[model samples]
Structures are given as structure tokens and as C-alpha cells.
Target: MMNKIFTYSLTLAFCFFSTVSYAKKSIEHCEATQNTTSGLSSCLDVVKEAVDRELQTWINNQVFILEEFALATGRRAALDMFKRSQRNFITFRENDCRWQYLAISPGTGAASAYKKCYILVSKSRIKELEVINP
Candidate 1:
């Protein structure tokens, strides 16, 4: 009888701890949704800022490596051109901030293969494109 009682007690204790552990700490979505106008706005703003920072962390590393590559290759000219042209380049605008190749001529005029071209890559796309030709 004592052995059975011990087993039952352990099982009950385990279930209680398990349920508590599984419970979420965050308030319910419906509770937030029902909040006053200003409160909801503040909550949304906080969430938005958090999401933006997380996104920046993901893209910042790629920017750092690309900056190093640009300096090493003396390709800042092409990078400047690409940034200026991004608003005009429809295809690049669609790349989700991933690296895009920009071809530029070293001379003042139109771009050409003879003058030399610079390949600009984003950090996110570097691993996949490393072994491949541009």
C-alpha cells in the first residue's frame, strides 16, 4: 500500500510540474487585443522595434564582410554606383537585401567588360555564391 501511494504521489507531482512548465509566461493575445487604444499602440511599437533590431542583426554581418571585400578589391566605386542605382534597379529591389552584382566601368563613361567589373555580394548570399562564378 505504501509503495502504491509513493508511485501515485510522484506521478501527480510530475504532472503538476509538467503543466506549469508548459504554460506560457506571456499574456493572452486576446487580452492584448482587447486593450485600450494607447496601450495597444505602445505594445505594437515595442514589438515592431524588437523585430526591426532582430532583422538588423541578421543583415549587419553581411554588410560588414562586404565592406571588407569592397576595400580589399578597391571596388568602392562600384558599390557607390550600386547604392545610387538601387532605387532605379528593379531587380535588385526584389532581392530581400541580399547581395546583388553591380557591373561598372572604371572610367568616367559607360560601363564595359574591358574597363573591369566589380561583383558586390551580401553576406547572406556569400556562402551559396562562394563556389560559383558570377
Candidate 2:
């Protein structure tokens, strides 16, 4: 009887953990894989697709500009910083200026130190726009 109760308790604990671990969320997103960011690959692709569809600029131009800036003098660190902040934009556009519009580049850096998924957009491209955290 004791063994039966012990086994049941262990089974119950495992089931609870498994269910909570596999939950799908919106604002709170986690990788499908175990502690790895590989699952976020699809999420990043979706974000880029949405950006391309809504924006008028050609994908070539956007990529070229991002590359150019990434190589320019005194801007490498800034570009890296932005990339690190954006986390390849997997989390979605942080500012959400569809009316004004903004461009992006793909990478694997987290948005912020405190937040795992944060998208950092260029303030220059977005004139009169403020990048505020909520």
C-alpha cells in the first residue's frame, strides 16, 4: 500500500510539471525545445514575413542598408548592440510603428539584459518616434 501511494505521488508530480512546461503562450514565449532558442527560428521568420508584406521597400535594399550600417566606422558596436537588443526580432517589433514604418535585420541576440525577447529598432529611420519600454 505504501509503495502504491509513493508511486502515485511521483506520477502526479511528473504529470503536473510536464503540462505546465509545454504550455503555449503569447506575451510569454518559450522555446519548444528544452532550454534552447532553436524553436524561435519560426517565430523570427514570421516576423520578417509580416514586415516585408506591410512595407514598401524591397528586401534587397533593407538587407543592404543593414549590412552597410553594420560595417560602417564607429557603428559596428552600435549595430552589435542593436542586434543583441533585438534577438533577431523574434519577439516582434517593439515600437509597432506600422503607420510610420521601420526596417529590421535578423540575428540571435536577446532584446535586453533583463528581458529575453526584445526588438530594438532604429530611431533614425523612425523620425520623431520614441523607443519607450512598457
Candidate 3:
């Protein structure tokens, strides 16, 4: 009975560790696969997609708050200003990331750099918007 229990426990522990190791390796596989431009671009695309989703969520929340504020306060101008500010911010983000991309060479790291810049800026904007409440 003791040997059987020990064997089962060891098997369970091994399986658990094996699963954890595989999970980590799968996550690192993208960056570990190759150092090629395309591989890096693909990784950046994944990162950008995640950041874009987060940004969209924050934007949605902010818009909802602004909408409620406009209705409650009867100040449509606030919402309008927010819309304009968002547009201007988008333009600025694009221009800024383009500049960052251009700061590097054309082929190698520019695309990744641009995407990274977008992620960083979008996250910062989310944090900024989080401070505003209805």
C-alpha cells in the first residue's frame, strides 16, 4: 500500500511539472524559434494585438463614462472634446511610432519597434483615462 501510494504521488508530481514546463516553453517558443525579421514581426503582432484589445477596453470604458457625464451634466461639449482628443491622440501615436520606426534601419527592427511603441503609448493612455470617473 505504501509503495502504491508513493508511486501515484510521484506520477502526479511528474505530470504536474511536465505540464508547467510545456506551458512555459510554448510561450517562449515564438521568441525562441528564430531570430529572423519575420519571426520577430510575428511576435510583435501578437503583442500588439493584446495591447490593442486592452486599449479598446479602456476606450470603451472612457466613452461610456463620458456619455453618462454628458447626459447627466447636459454638457455635450465634453464628449465632443473627448472624441476630438482621441482622434488627435491617434494621429500623434501614429506619427510618433513612425518616427521611432524610422530611427532604426528600414528592414531589421523597425516594425517591431513601431509596434512596441504603440503598445507602450496605448497602455499609458489607458492609465491616463483610468483616472477620470463619471
Candidate 4:
């Protein structure tokens, strides 16, 4: 059973990585832009949108897979758990970004810091979910 689980997890990870490899360039480009000051906040906003879309796509795919699994096995708990985990992740991102914002308070870089935090955290979460979920 352990071997089976490991193999399944590995396969899911490979698929997830393959899907997101194409978006890596965009992610890298946005990371590169983080240091620049020319309209940095607005630029981060756009990048955040794109990153958020990627995150959403990943979540949707996971949900669909979980739903299908539930249908086949009649084990609906996994889908519910996944939904809860996603909601918790959102709350975590918001609170974490708020902390990032506060870390730069009384400074002009606060907004950019917040947005950058969101992008970084969201990207990290995407990679994390890809590894952890089917």
C-alpha cells in the first residue's frame, strides 16, 4: 500500500510539473521585475493576476480529480478536505501578506511588498499543492 501511494504521488507530481513548466518563464520574469522601481506596484498587480490564474487553474484541476476519485470510490471526504484546505490556504496567504505589508509600514514600498508577498506565497502554494495532492 505504501509503495502504491508513493507511485501515485510521484506520477501526480510529474504531471503537475509538466503542466506548470510552461508558465515558469512568466514567473521568472515577474520575479526579475521585483527589484525595479519603475511602476513596481502596478506591475506586481498584473503579475499577481497572472499568478492567481495559474493558482486557480491548479486548484480546479485538483478539485476535478478529487471529484472523480470520490465518484469512483464513494469516499467524498477527500474532496471536502481539499476544499477546506484551499480555504485555509487563502486565509493563510492573506494573513501572511498582511504581515509582509506591515513589515514595510511607514514606507512607500509597503504596497509593493504586500503584492510581492502575495505572488511569492501563491506561487509557493501552487508548487506545494502539486506535490501534496493528486
**Which candidate wins on lDDT?**
4
lDDT of 1 by residue, 29-114 (tens): 32346356445434434433433333243333334445655877977765565345434443443342222222222332222111
Which structure is stronger by TM-score: 3 or 4?
A: 4
Alpha-carbon TM-score of each model against the true structure: 0.34, 0.22, 0.70, 0.73
Q: All models: lDDT?
A: 0.37, 0.36, 0.69, 0.75
Worst 10-residue stretch by lDDT in candidate 3? 21-30
Regions of candidate 4 where Cα sits further than 4 Å from its true position = 1-38, 132-134
Tens digit of per-residue lDDT, candidate 2, span 18-94: 33642442123433432544455544444333333322122223333445666665467654555564453424444
Full ranking by lDDT: 4, 3, 1, 2
Model 1 deviation from the true structure expressed as Cα RMSD, one decimal place: 21.7
Error of 4 at 111 (Å): 0.5
lDDT of 3: 0.69
- RMSD (CA, angstroms), candidate 2: 21.5
C-alpha positional error of residue 117 in candidate 2 after TM-score superposition, expressed in Å: 16
Candidate 2 whole-model C-alpha lDDT, 0 to 1: 0.36
Q: If the candidates were sorted by their TM-score against the true structure, best first, what order would they fall in?
A: 4, 3, 1, 2
Could you give candidate 4's per-residue lDDT for residues 1-134 as a string of tens digits?
46447655655675566556545434455556557654676667777876787788678767877887898799999999989999999999999999988988968888878887898898898888768654
Which regions of candidate 2 are displaced past 4 Å?
1-63, 92-134
Give, for candidate 1, the lowest lDDT window spanning 10 residues. 111-120
